[model samples]
Target: MLDKNVNLEGKNILVTGAAGFIGSNLVLELLKTLKSVNIVGIDSVNDYYDVKIKEWRLEELEKEAKTHKDSTWKFVKGNIADRGLIDSIFAKFKPAVVVNLAAQAGVRYSIINPDAYIEANIIGFYNILEACRHSYDNGEKGVEHLVYASSSSVYGTNKKVPYSTDDKVDNPVSLYAATKKSNELMAHAYSKLYNIPSTGLRFFTVYGPAGRPDMAYFGFTNKLIKGENIQIFNYGNCKRDFTYVDDIVEGIKHVMQSAPARKNGEDGLPIPPYAVYNIGNSNPENLLDFVTILQEELVRAEVLPRDYDFELHKKLVPMQQGDVPVTYADTTALERNFGFKPSTDLRTGLRKFAEWYKEFYKV
Candidate 1:
């Protein structure tokens, strides 16, 4: 249900990466809260993971839209890398609010395919900025807030426990992180030059039902199902603040309304309307304990049989390149502005994933 306090009625909001986990979820929430709000969502729907899951998310959104009294939702299958397509969509939609969740996600994958990152993250993001700058070109244009996704990877193996938005993020271990950091930089430049109200969200380990299968939980689940030994990195020594998708969606909704207004002497100042925040659980969980809890939940969800051999089917190895030791969020900025912070823990979030995976796969 939409929050009665928040009214996005009749506003045209564009959500890029609408077919991805967080994007699809955000689309649903926007529809419920706003009256007759037209949501135009775009996704390249590449084969990074199982494209089937992406297709399923779109189908689910279509079903939701079909039930609504008015057809306020439109899903476009295309790459953000396509400048012509991005410009055309902007010209037609003339969206008032733009949320960019469309990213070439995954840290390890970025290392393998450097070109994809350059193309999608760099080229694609530039196209978004260009289109957004010119979105109000004609007359009385309504491009207001532009929100894009950043990553916890920007912290880049910091010794700091709670990674704050104020901390220096100059060094990123992976190309993906580097690209995301570049995105923040690019958005900052656009916000300053074009006077676009841009907000970048640096999301921490987001996981939930219908989440990305490439994540550790999903990969581990798949391996466990096939009776293959799951490899534990860093000798099972790592920590993550697994945030629930719903919480992240709610945070975005709140930010959309407030829409960072430029001020003096602030990060978004001068280019004032630009801001960045860390949306995370703010509570880190040890990886070994996380796996144990996840296994228990999988059994409860019936994804795994009782008495599954847990001891023999696992191996702890050294950490991989582009991998971090731990991540926690200092959500002071988010809380100060939005009056809230993500608080979902690993067990609860994993349980949701286990249930959904069971139902989706009928395991």
Candidate 2:
């Protein structure tokens, strides 16, 4: 395993998209793990799905911060696309580690609202790259590592069984996928030009308690709760490497401590100090089986009645635009380098979500 080159304890860290599902869970993990660490978070808290969920996440963060007396948490309500705001935050906090999780995240929504994807995914990410590039001014010790979120959508419709980082991702089927691919390219350019140590994580279908509502698992739960039919896309033939949110956060925490090693090439210039990895369960579950497990878990959690007619609430539908048949991750490199891999079973993960949903919505 690679030696951890960066230590997070007693350091200033910035996490964008603080109120988000993965972002909030990450902040809580950092707070629980590190002492005397100061964290600055930024999120627009837009009403993309539900603002109350974002607000609840921030409230949980507040509670977590109070428990960890030595750690500090400061949240800024704004957008990362705001260049002035981003510059000022970097100047003020001077964070040693920056984690960028803010972006327009839905594949289907991207088709309907392409502008949102360009504005947040493209322009917002560009602003982040520019901020990281300028952080090293005046010979100051700028950002030691930059970790950002990428998606498995970048894999597109490749027939490969398991997607690997070394595989070419030049063909993106959706605008969302295209924008994420763009993020990887932009980070590579910044890393080569300014020598920023950056790593991009291609996450599979991440799901768990307090997750994004747009996700299939969560959306299915919502629809079932209201007796509405949940559409099963690809006629139940689609498969996904559904990863648990906690597992994803654990992968991120490990990556944060180990940035790509910076070195000079034969040409006496930087070697781009860049890397990318896939964090996923590696085991793809068929969509129909996934829904079955979700339904059983919902019943077990008392979120749904045991006698509820699940057959009446599920509808098999054709594949939607911007969707691929399967997504499987090849995590050999991640385990070889970090000695970690996601192992959470789907039933256990879905059970947690069902229980959390029951309590959160007072069902």
Runs in model 1 with CA error above 4 Å? 1-7, 263-270
lDDT of all the models against the reference? Answer: 0.87, 0.96
The residue ranges of model 2 lying beyond 4 angstroms of the native Cα positions read none
Best by TM-score: 2
What's the distance in Å from true for residue 62, model 1?
0.7
What TM-score does candidate 1 reach?
0.95
Among all candidates shown, the one with the greatest lDDT: 2
Q: Compute each candidate's TM-score over C-alphas.
A: 0.95, 0.99
